[model samples]
Target: MRAVIFGASGLLGRSVVCAFNDMAVTGTCFSRTAGGLVTVDATSADDIERLLSRDQPDVVVNCVGERRPEVWAETPAQARGRNVEAARLIAEGACRYGVRLLHISSDYVFDGKAAPYRPDSLPNPLNAYGRWKLLAEHAVRAACPDAAILRLPVLYGSAQFAAETNLTKIARQVSAGVPMEMDDVCVRYPTHADEAAEVCRRLAGALLRGQRQGAVAHWGAEQGLTKYQMAQLIARRFSLSAGHIRAGEADAASGDRPVDCRLDCHDLPAALGPLRRWLFHTEFPPVVEPWLLPARPVSS
Candidate 1:
């Protein structure tokens, strides 16, 4: 099968590329980049159409979206453009070409008010980031009823975290000797990028083979943990002092975020089989402290 991945250079996109089993994996990256990879901006429908027509892929998995949790407050418009508008263009192109779309979404779509959200639950996004992601999901579904919107939770990995607040970033700050603050309250399910990519490959492959993932599909790991606990795991993984990872108001501002944002994969399980089994069967090794650590404490 032929697969064309948009944003093929990003963390999730890279993993999806790796998951393909010599499946004629064509790719599209944005301009202003030269990496021997095809350049096509997902924000432009014309660009998407041009590439889709050229590649004629059987499946189109979209991983093109920006994530600037640190700078969201200053650049709300840009954030919306990246998270929302990009989804619209891809969905439109997929409908035009009659290609199956696997639109990668996020756990951020929920307000964190509810834990273990089912696929059918109505979304109430509290933050701007969450709202934008929800916008994308809606656009994708409306554009192509056949598309699968695979929503997962906080992503963590040596590769993804390294690009977006992995141990290296944490160590750089902690080694500088500034006290690191973490929220004990905020909890999430952190899925490794490679694992998530594998899940996508499995789910998309099944769908291509005429399998159903139910009405709404979810993809994530089997368990969830708190940010405070996550930090301890990270500390262990790198031999850093968990003592330096402080808790309390000064560092625990993110406690204001809705407490339980974890997703329930029961239906996803019924549709895709046991996530734990899939995770163990794969060759990917888990880190000593593999929990998803909060990037920064939420403000009260």
Candidate 2:
């Protein structure tokens, strides 16, 4: 089985690459071309078409997107280019080449007013990022009717930088003994990138076998936690004091966020057997610890 993974240098993409290690995989990146990742401008239709023709892979997984909500709110055009245009180009290429596509989407597509959302649920995105993602989904589906769409929540995994992901950023602050306020209001299901990668691999396999065509599925951690609870877990794991971390309302500066977008994930479990979720207490420490700064000296 041959596969092409776009945005292969990203958090989820890296894990997806590892998950498909047994297969012939070609990983592409836009700018961060490390670990032998091929550089390809995903927004360019010609670039996408050329790659699809050259690789001739049975499956294509798109992991590229502007995940920053503030980017969409601040610079809508740039964000739309990355999030929507890129996806459209990829989907067009996949349709032309008759290749199976699995596109990564976000849970933000739905307003937090609804607790657990299914695949068929009406998407009422509140923020620009969500709105763009929803648009991207429509574009992808229109271009490639058989494309598989997988919606995921906040992801945490091995990152080169602490700021690459929200959870690792919190871990960084906690490790530094930096006094900070975390959101106790919004509920989030932070899924590990590795777990999402596994789901991607399984779905890709199914797609190759002529299954799950035009299917929309959700994969998220069943455990619901807030930024405050996540910080506390990080503190406990590293034996660091969480005294400086206080639970409060969501940071307004971070931009508009959902209250709770817990995904039902019924389709994924039904299609792929049981959903595999990693335990936060056991799996999170190693993923975040490597990026943490050196411990500061205690003041006398």
Clashing residue pairs, candidate 1? 161-166, 253-298, 253-299, 254-297, 254-298
Worst lDDT 10-window in candidate 1: 280-289
Off by over 4 Å in 1: 31-35, 160-163, 166-168, 249-256, 276-300
lDDT (Cα, 0-100) at 207 in candidate 2: 94
* Count of clashing residue pairs in every prediction: 5, 0
Question: Residue 239 in candidate 2 has what lDDT?
Answer: 81
Q: Residue 229 of model 1: what lDDT?
A: 64
Can you write out model 2's per-residue Cα lDDT over 120-143, one digit (the tens) per residue?
999988788898899999999999
Candidate 1, RMSD to the unseen true structure: 5.7
TM-score of decoy 2: 0.95
What is the alpha-carbon RMSD of candidate 2 to the true structure?
1.6
Q: What is the clash tally of candidate 1?
A: 5
